[model samples]
Target: MKASTISLIIHGVDVDVVYKKVKYLRIGVYPPLGQVRVSAPTRFGHEQVRLAVIERLPWILRQREHFQTVERQSRREMVSGESHVVFGAAHRLQVIEQPGRERVEADADHLLLFVQAGSTPEHRLALLERWLREQLRQAVIALIAVWEQRLQVTVPQWTIRQMKTRWGSCNPQTRRISFNSELARKPPHCLEYIVVHEMAHYFHDGHGDGFTGFMDSHLPDWRSQRRELNKR
Candidate 1:
């Protein structure tokens, strides 16, 4: 069954509630404007959802405030025993001292970060970002190739960026797609979804009926992928 959505204003906050066949209620505060969304089971009505929103109003406002406070940044410290996500897996960071070369290697359950002695946080962060970019690049290239043949379309170009508001974007005129470098931190399948989502824009620009239809035909569970991408 198709989901139905309704809008509600709770304690001066606008919330979009979607009723679906899920077993529980989930509320998320999204970025760019801290938009709040709630997924309630089909059995729940406006009052139930509204009460849930009311209970979480304080948390919702705090999330909104957090988004307002920080646009985007790679805030991880270059230290050992820290948590870092690479390709959707939680890897323990193991910092090792080396000279002249800063590199990162992902093992079974740990990320081996080799850096020069006394390397600053910024230095190590830059090194890690570079590594993530390369990883994202390789994955996106393969995804683009697969989707290109599957969709029977050609992409002019694609690049990775540290985007603050979007996972991916496409220019229909240029046939160029830009993926967020942050995709490296998410699941591999999320990267595939972004590639397909951007490439689909070649046929449909805005997310209207045509765009939704195209996405549904190609990636039937795109909505779930999108939800996972936006999980808080």
Candidate 2:
């Protein structure tokens, strides 16, 4: 069964339609932005694919709405009353001006930032970024340890960094995984999903049947979590 791919536009959304040697049609909406992709039998023509997308247009719009309403929040000013997310919970930020160590503390409803008086917004942002990075790193490390034992694979290294397009990535040859720093702002389960997804790559490099099967066996609700993560 040979495979080929092409692109088309439906209702103003760019779509990637893949012709594969398969039995049924499958469609998916992916993130950072909602990218619509369809997989159809090689026998299906472009018109068939376009009609399928048209049938799912409502669902596609809903998925895009989730990304816009949840994941694409307004720019942060890092000031009091600003909304911040931690562990999937929304918290209001409270900046406390004090001549002490710059740090962050969080309770159920507030992310308190203690900074010196007259600190610039840039300085405040830097402090928050460092704290978020540390938080993400700790979460990634703990998850890696757990998955490594379960998957029976030794990860040589892993790091948390800003990624514009991916939630996480793996280099199986190097046994290293890199997580997006933004995971700190998403729900805990989302972070866990990315960790396990990357670790699964240790056994399966691509998102083919083998990898999908492995994920289903390990995390039954992975698809749900993945949708939520992309919405963040």
Candidate 3:
């Protein structure tokens, strides 16, 4: 059955309540920003769900604090000496103001941003994001080639966007997929795992046994990669 959802504000935090046919209530804090979600048995009312969230309030607050720390890390100032992530490694940013078109370049431990002398932070960010998108695109294309054949599915189209709460999503009917641009900041393996994961959705709709089996058969270490990718 499809779960019914209700939205609530508890102690200044937004909570999404999903009523499911389960015996117990489950709570989770998700990322990009701290989003609290609760899975409650269908028999429970909204009051019961609220109480459940209050009972676990401390733990939820801690989890939200962790996500805030991660958010601050991702929100950069676009200046020299600022720490930035590229391909899962921390790279210090160096803004080199010059006379040409703005471009982003990086070595093993540093990101060299060449701007037009007086570029604003927004302009620098735009340049960096443009570069990151191309990086993610090339990686996705190569991975899709291998995965489409292995999974026996064709991805008619795919896109990269700034998703606040999801690493990736897919439309099985359209045979199209979308990946989070944030994946560019993660390891290559993480991106590969997401590609295979979304592609597998063409066969299975949810994370049920069918999807689990598919992932297990194809990528045995997917759980580890998931943990790494979810880590801030």
How many residue pairs clash in all the candidates, one count each?
0, 1, 0
Candidate of highest lDDT: 3
lDDT of 3 by residue, 57-162 (tens): 9999998888878777667779999988877888999999989777888889998999998788888998998998998999999999998788777899999998
What TM-score would you give candidate 1 relative to the actual structure?
0.73
Best candidate according to TM-score: 3
TM-score of 2: 0.75
What pairs collide in candidate 1? none
Candidate order by TM-score, highest to lowest? 3, 2, 1
Report the lDDT tens digits of candidate 2 across residue range 23-110: 9999987776566778889899999889999999999989867665655565577789988888789989999999868899989999
Candidate 3 backbone collisions, by pair: none
Query: Which model, 1 or 3, shows the larger lDDT?
Result: 3
**Global lDDT for candidate 2?**
0.84
Please give the distance, in angstroms, between residue 136's alpha carbon in candidate 1 and its true position after superposition. Answer: 0.4
- Residue 68 displacement in candidate 3 (angstroms): 5.1
lDDT of 1 by residue, 131-206 (tens): 9899889888888889889989999888898765567778889998898887898898888888888888788755
Better of 2 and 3 by TM-score: 3
